[model samples]
Target: MPRRDSPGPESWETLFTGISHLVTPAPGPQRGPAMRELTVVEDAALLVQGGLVAWVGPRRDAPRTPSTRDLGGVAVVPGLVDPHTHAVWAGDRLADFEARLAGVPYEEMLARGGGIRSTVRATAAAPMEELVQLARPRLEALARSGATTVEVKSGYGLDFEAEVRMLRAVRELQSLLSVTLLPTLLIHVPPETGRAAYVQAVCAELIPQVAGEGLAVAVDVFCEREAFTVGETRAILSAARGHDLGVKLHADQFHALGGVELACDLGALSVDHLEASGPAQIVALAASETVATVLPGVTLHLGLPAAPARALIDAGACVAVGTDLNPGSSPLFNAGLALALAVRLNGLTPAEALTAGTVNAAAALGLRDRGALAAGQRADFLALHSPDWRDLVYTLGASPVRDVFVGGERISL
Candidate 1:
């Protein structure tokens, strides 16, 4: 529980002043381009006590604190919340990427044992300590890019033992860093042999052990033509719900199936990767609580079409953005860069993309107190070198993050 660098004084209570622009997205029922009506304050001040925001307003009205740090007129916004990432694994998928660029379809590559399976084999072979060691750098890169909270999925470990290893590694990583990592049990793809038996083991045995040990907070499934069917997704998610674990879905990434509809029916926390989503899916998502989390990193990495970010936003659905960090798919660790991609590639405006990556993304991960820069919320905001927050999206492939404060503790940028 050592402070990463120290946001301010030794007591962890400090006042932050001299912010040029404060981007605080309004708490609401839905998100989109128009709902980007976030509250902006000029020359703002924030009081942090015990790692939480105690007061925020104009500097003239700010109360005295034990310590204070002035940002020197930098733009401060909520720390990035990446709702989808596969951060615990061991392998390289450069060959698969080369094949994908050569016009080999992703599904075909999966069938040929060159995609997730290949990585799963390598991940399964790795020891727990080794997996944790390899994953620390990826999470650190994300933290450096402005992420304070990220959801890490355990899908590369396809079997019970390997999945346990990955989830344990994720838990250990959480203790080792100031950034919070939410672990997800993604029974990624059915094993190459005896898919039914594997599904049963995941549902009956793995879920019990994982839940009993409190290793994961949510369960995820890859519901695609190449992955599990809609029926299988339903069954797995139902078991996860029975164990009181939150539900998430990797739905409609490549092909349009009924994954969105089923995820809505189950009241999932989030439904990710809607690359093939159409008007109907957008409408359905608008009426549901499930956050439509689109990963621009995945689309840009795979050279595929972008998700319907604008449509989902304009339709009143809660939209969020993620890095989709993985080996074979979206392997990038820069969440700020992903935000830029969400603006340019996914058609989300700067304000909308920031909202999606912050408060809405926190909602996707079921964290109520860590998204906004408001009283009673965790003091989790990052400073950008630019005076305007839009510069975060305008400068693609760049890290504008200069400083990061998680729970009032300053971590290195």
Candidate 2:
């Protein structure tokens, strides 16, 4: 590797060759303008220049480069894009996990001001620097596990001050790690404040401030029976879109409250946690650009039924996978494990699951340029120590990754 004062096309050097398999892009039905077809070359090679992909093709046709690093017989896939997560918060909820396993229902826990409320309390109490310190390791760990892009939400901090604190922490991590982060302000089902007041605060105060500062890339709302009603959900999301922020919804997790339909109607970037979403919603999503993001870990962790991932994919709906990494429901953060669970438990094919974690996930985050190994796409990808690409999910609990890269730079452990 060499360093230059201002690296340009002339500084382009280094080639990665001898790859056993390369899943360049995961194909979807009729690649739309916002979507692209990823190409996989067998025994492939990639040429990188100035931290960007220069060329990629079969090893035999690999263009000559000044320098090269040959990784013998390894599978190289695009680095994962985890489109949904709630990774920035304080305190552990391991005790809540034990209580849930002991037969306490999740609804009961939330009614007692436990679940999300507990996390909100903890997050509000922690200092910004402390939150940053705690969250840095988790983001780094995701990078080490082959996730190059992840979305961080700000729901734990329900109020303006606390919410901005979480967003600031999310921004700080971006400057410190190799992982690219998409920050979303999750106005998680308001506080004890009245509906109208909460609406006023979010629509009139918080959303504007967040957008004005360019702090959040998207806005999210939890739309369940226990959370905001369809009417309230509409108010929040509509106001968010008014500010030119992309919309996302936490819909159909515990019940089907028409959140999925609402998400499709608004053309949300993605709608997450569809444990109760049905065929009509799936069809609507298939016909729309809104990505159907499924969280199998939440269902698995909560002892609930996983979303119908197979049906959605079968209907030509663009699907994405994510760790709804939160305190009460899903504490699991490993993207590889999430993909494996999606394959066996959520009824998705290995190829479909891979797409969910990669390109589709990137779309869910409103990122148009990343999530594939194309000439113009970012040079972020992963090197797996497996002979076959399918083995990554076929062997559910195993970690076969050897190295992770972002912008053509190998992530340091």
Candidate 3:
């Protein structure tokens, strides 16, 4: 292979070559058998201009450019997109972990104030700068593990002021990190007392303030038995839609509470944590545009049943994977490991797992920009350490990503 001095990071146009294989999914969210489809180009070259992909094809047919970089014959794939995560928080859940390990059910821990409520109390006391400082390393760890885009939810701060502070912390982290951060205002759990007042505050005060400040692009509700009821979720999500913010739900993780049907009816961007989804829920998801996002890391950490990913996909639903990175239920930091576990737990093929972590995941976040390595997409991709892209999912306890690029510029890992 021929090599040339790499262009400066600020170069206007650059062509990248020497890829052993370039694997990517088709444009848009894939469903059914299409989810298994991947385009593999041998000896591929990518042309990036102004931080967007200009062309991608065989190197022999690649248009010549003034600046070029050879990736040294490594496999390349679209950078992983983590669409569902609770990545911003203040404290650890070590005690909660121990209790769960001792056979105390997760709901039992939450009811006794050892789960999300525990984190909420700690996070509410932390300053915004402290929150940012604490979350920086976790986001960097995700970046190093092949995640170029991560969705961060502010759920630990359950009250109005605390929640807004949490969103601001996420904004601060965004400026200090290389990965793209999408903030969400998550309504985690209702207060022990004054549940009605809290829901009213979220709809009449928190949603409006967060939307007006441009702090969050989406609003999420935890609709389950131990969280907000289905009726309360409807009101909160309706307020978000009125404010032009997208909606998502943490549903069916422990029991089917009609959250999936409500999400579909509301036209939510995605419904996540479907560990308890049944045939009826799968049917509803398959018929709706809402992406079904499965969090394998949660299953791995909590010892829960895997979400019905195979059934959803077979029924033509768009399926995606996420880390659900959080202190309580899931402490996973690696996006690559999420994909690997999805294959073993969720019955997704390596190709489907890659698509789930990329294009479909992007769709779940309502982003059409950076999931595929094709013209008009952002030049965000990964150069794998191995020649085969499947190694990313096949390898256990290791990351196959050797280098990561965002907006056509290489980022230090």
Q: lDDT for model 1, please.
A: 0.87
Pairs that collide, model 1: 32-313
lDDT of candidates 1 onward, in order: 0.87, 0.81, 0.92
For 48-99, candidate 1 gives per-residue lDDT tens digits of: 8888888888888889876898998999998889999999989889888888
Residue-level lDDT tens digits of model 3 in 267-332: 999999999999999999999999999999989998899999999999999999999999987899
TM-score (all chains, Cα) for each model: 0.96, 0.93, 0.96
TM-score (C-alpha, index-matched) for candidate 2: 0.93
The positional error of residue 385 in candidate 1, measured at the CA in angstroms, is: 0.9
Task: Output the better candidate (2/3) by lDDT.
Answer: 3
Per-residue alpha-carbon lDDT of model 2 for 30-90, expressed as tens digits? 2222222445588999888767778888999988777888888889988888888898999
**How far in Å is the alpha carbon of 235 misplaced in model 2?**
1.5
Ranking by TM-score: 3, 1, 2
Worst 10 residues of 3 by lDDT: 1-10
lDDT of 3 at 187: 95
